[model samples]
Target: MNITINTTVLPHLDPDESVAFYRDSLGFEVRSDVGSGTMRWIVVGPAAQPETSVLLAPPAADPGVTDEERRVIREMMAKGTYGWLLLAADDLDDTFQAVSAAGAEVVQEPTEQPYGARDCAFRDPAGNMIRIQERR
Candidate 1:
């Protein structure tokens, strides 16, 4: 059996802001944005990994998702331990500016990793750590 993890659902404090970061900073192609009353179900993927995508989701408000799950997610965000959302970009400097201009809080300035990745770290509006990386 060939199995692949194509999509991951991530907690977003504000879907719009997270979407903007992905779309503008890293130049991700937006698959959907209804702009209606519901929480925006935004999905983005590596330009090369067309079949694999990540979903920006709000704490599940559906009746199906139990309160315990919601509490766990909220607690995770509150503790600032949800880990980093890593993104790959063509230009590390430009992408850093793009995210900065969009008003993301910089956690770490762009720097070259020992392994040769030029990377910067920022926080999503929802307080998720996002790292933009470019290979040297």
Candidate 2:
């Protein structure tokens, strides 16, 4: 069996800001955008990897979630503990420089990890942690 990731969902408080972060800062191509305002759902992916994409959706849009759960989600998102994405780059330093220059909130500078990987991190507009590792 052949399996591959099609899309991953990330909750967004503000749709426009999330779109800007993934499209402008991360350089992902916007495949589609629907809805409007905070109700927007966006699909984005690296131009080279057309098969994989990320979906940015409103955090409390799920009908199954209670009001209290939504409140907790908002609190977690504000604390930068709710959503995250892990990506990789061929050139870690160059990627770091470009993202930093694009005004992404820097969480950590590129550093060689004790586990033998070099990576850096940043926070998206809604406080989702985005960690980029050097492609091995």
Most lDDT-accurate candidate: 2
Q: Which ranges in model 2 have alpha carbons more than 4 Å from their true place?
A: none
Model 2 per-residue lDDT tens digits across residues 29-81: 99999998789999999999999999999998979999999999999998789
Clashes of each: 0, 0
- Candidate 2 clash pair list: none
- Runs in model 1 lying further than 4 Å from the true structure: 1-5, 33-38, 46-49, 62-69, 113-118
- How high is each candidate's TM-score? 0.71, 0.96
* Candidate 1 lDDT, 1-136, residue by residue in tens: 9999788766776777777777775567777664444467778766778897778776675779888987887778765567457777778888788778877788889898897778989876667778878854
RMSD of each: 3.3, 0.9
For residue 117, give model 1's deviation from the true position in Å: 4.8
- TM-score of model 1 relative to the true fold? 0.71
- 52 in model 1: Cα distance from truth in Å? 3.1
